[model samples]
Target chain A: MARDTRERLLDAGLALFAGNGLAGTTVSDLEARAGLRAGSGSFYRHFTSKEALFEAVVRQELDRFRTSIGDTTIGESTVADVKIALALEFHEALTTLGQLGQLEAIIHRDAHAMGDLFDEVEGLYNAALDASAARLNQLMESGQLPRRDPQALAVTIRSTLIGYHLNTQSFRRSARRVPPADLIAILIDLISSK
Target chain B: MARDTRERLLDAGLALFAGNGLAGTTVSDLEARAGLRAGSGSFYRHFTSKEALFEAVVRQELDRFRTSIGDTTIGESTVADVKIALALEFHEALTTLGQLGQLEAIIHRDAHAMGDLFDEVEGLYNAALDASAARLNQLMESGQLPRRDPQALAVTIRSTLIGYHLNTQSFRRSARRVPPADLIAILIDLISSK
Candidate 1:
């Protein structure tokens, strides 16, 4: 029941933090929401503090996310294929993240207050970006991708994917949901045509 | 002097809100930082509540941002030129907002708590996107641009510029700043090359 308790704690903590933010949520509140007895020694047995629990949750979610995307498989077959692969990789990464709303809430909450936390989140994002940039550079060097600033391209592709992700994901309004794959194709076309 | 006092109050509130979130800041904090007497009726005369003052600051900042960008003047001389112009406009808009960290803070804080406020902010962003999309449609119709999904390109361009803006502006410790114009050029090339 220990792992179950920790999982429940993470679930409860994520929901509370997303809804009330870090400063607003308390350890007691988390304990109550987790279906654990109040003043139980079980809470401290798993994690030292709420922040530690938060980091655990974030790491778990990110790990799941990276696994979901799998390793980005690129093809040198055509410029179109390369662009599509990049878009697909970026889209999958964002799609996995957007569904949970965990990282979004954390990034938007206490981002200014929690320096190390934000840096960790930002590092994950930038690392993904750096990978894409390096890939772009390799493609350009091989003459598949045209001569373009790989860093800027990496940033552009990422920003495009994130902006798209933010607009569409988790929106509860009555509207058409553009399929993420469709967006990837559109983005690739835009890149390929240019 | 009254107007000057109100301006000072707005200035102080912006600084406080940016440094500490809305919940963390107090009315007394605003008054003290503004150099006004604590618990003075003057605060009530200018604004109904701290939230109202925050709204005013947000609106003023958005308006100032709009004015700073001026009208989107597009010289329909060439496809590349128009794309560049639109990219420049988007970059400038995001740069102005990101520099002050006003909208970013407001969006992060009270985002879940204040639905109407977040909607207003989202509206401003979407409206800007809609305008850009409309312009792209017009250009495409006149054969100035290409026959692509104006909507997708609009979203893509806007998203890319915003993503770039979020990454660079006000990131305290930085080795090199990618001039926003450079980003715009890179984005425009990506589109134009395709």
Candidate 2:
């Protein structure tokens, strides 16, 4: 029962934060958005403050992201399989959390001020790169890809995807738009080449 | 003389915006930072609000970017010259402006809102891509690069640079950084291949 209330509070906080922004949002906003009355009394019963509640939401999101990292079956999957899987969901995860955009915005804002939060953001990116690199290393070792430094190549591919996500924010005007399959195909070609 | 005041205001706005962010900053901050007390009181004499001032600042920075496009001697320069002279400076101008830790936070905030600001952002990116494409077209016409749509290739290169910028914010743990020269070299090689 206690755990469920905490989860509900987080969901409510995410919605409020999304609508109002971190700095723009207030304790009353969270309390009202949660649809729970009893003033600050009930709210404080569950979480210490709005900032604490916001921090919990970030932790929950990071934990969810960490869980997804475990899903990358690098040893079992082919390069093409991994690439396709990544493209399908990567940008969405970065930009949105269901209906709430607060998660991305909150982290992007405070990551500058808070060292620990910044570390978590960095860790998430590195984990993804490491997973991708592991797959590339396997491909090279198996003679599927040309001999390449999997780490460096992984960085390149990872950077390419990061670039792709950023460009997705501005794809409408660019003359060349590479669809997900084509992007993956290009990567496969680049990796498999000598 | 009037034109020079506008220019000085823009120069001051960029430095202040880069340090304090768009929302956190105020006209007083701008005036104090610019060392123009009465002249700064005179700031509103020209622009109505801080928003208007920001729009002016954004325009000035963007114009500086567009000037680099004008500097590209597309028809006269070789592929190597474009990479060394035009492309590298273009990359620098982008990094110098967008890579500021505070400015990106402001951009990230606005971008999350999914508003008309996106169009303005896209226009600047596309302008850069167009400039690069014109140069690439010249190279292809001269039989230096494979004859393909230079616009398409230019978009790809712009996307690659966008990705690097995103990584600077999104990935904090990858101490394995690639210098802009090596990265630009890799991108040039990718697009110029026959």
The sequence of per-residue lDDT tens digits that candidate 1 reaches over residues A1-194 is 55688889988887877666676677888888898786776689889987888777777766665654345454232446676566656566666657656666655555664556566656666666677778779877977667777887776777666656655532333113345665677677765554
DockQ of all predictions against the true structure, Cα-based: 0.39, 0.34
Worst 10 residues of 2 chain B by lDDT: B97-106
Of the candidates shown, which would achieve the greatest lDDT relative to the real structure? 1
Candidate 1 residues lying further than 4 Å off, grouped into runs, are: A1-3, A36-80, A99-101, A112-122, A169-179, B1-3, B36-49, B62-80, B99-101, B169-177
Give the Å shift of residue A170 in candidate 2.
6.0
lDDT of candidate 2 at residue A156, scale 0 to 100:
62
> Scored by CA lDDT, what does every candidate get?
0.66, 0.58
| A-chain TM-score of every model | 0.73, 0.67
TM-score per candidate, chains pooled: 0.78, 0.72
What tens digits encode model 2's per-residue C-alpha lDDT throughout B8-124? 767667776554455546777777665567434777765787777777766555555556546645435444654465456446645654634334444554444435655665666
Categorize the docking of model 1. acceptable
- Residue-level lDDT of model 1, residues B8-112, one tens digit each, is 989987777755667667788898888877777668777899988887777777776566535545423344667756665656666565764565655555556
Candidate number achieving the greatest DockQ relative to the actual structure: 1
lDDT of 2 by residue, A1-194 (tens): 34566677888876655444555566666666666663556778789877788778778777776775665453464446544544443443333333223455455445554448667767676777676677668766866666555666666665665555545532432235556445545544444434
Q: Which stretches of model 2 miss by more than 4 angstroms?
A: A1-9, A12-21, A28-46, A78-105, A170-178, B1-20, B26-48, B74-76, B79-106, B111-118, B133-153, B169-175, B192-194
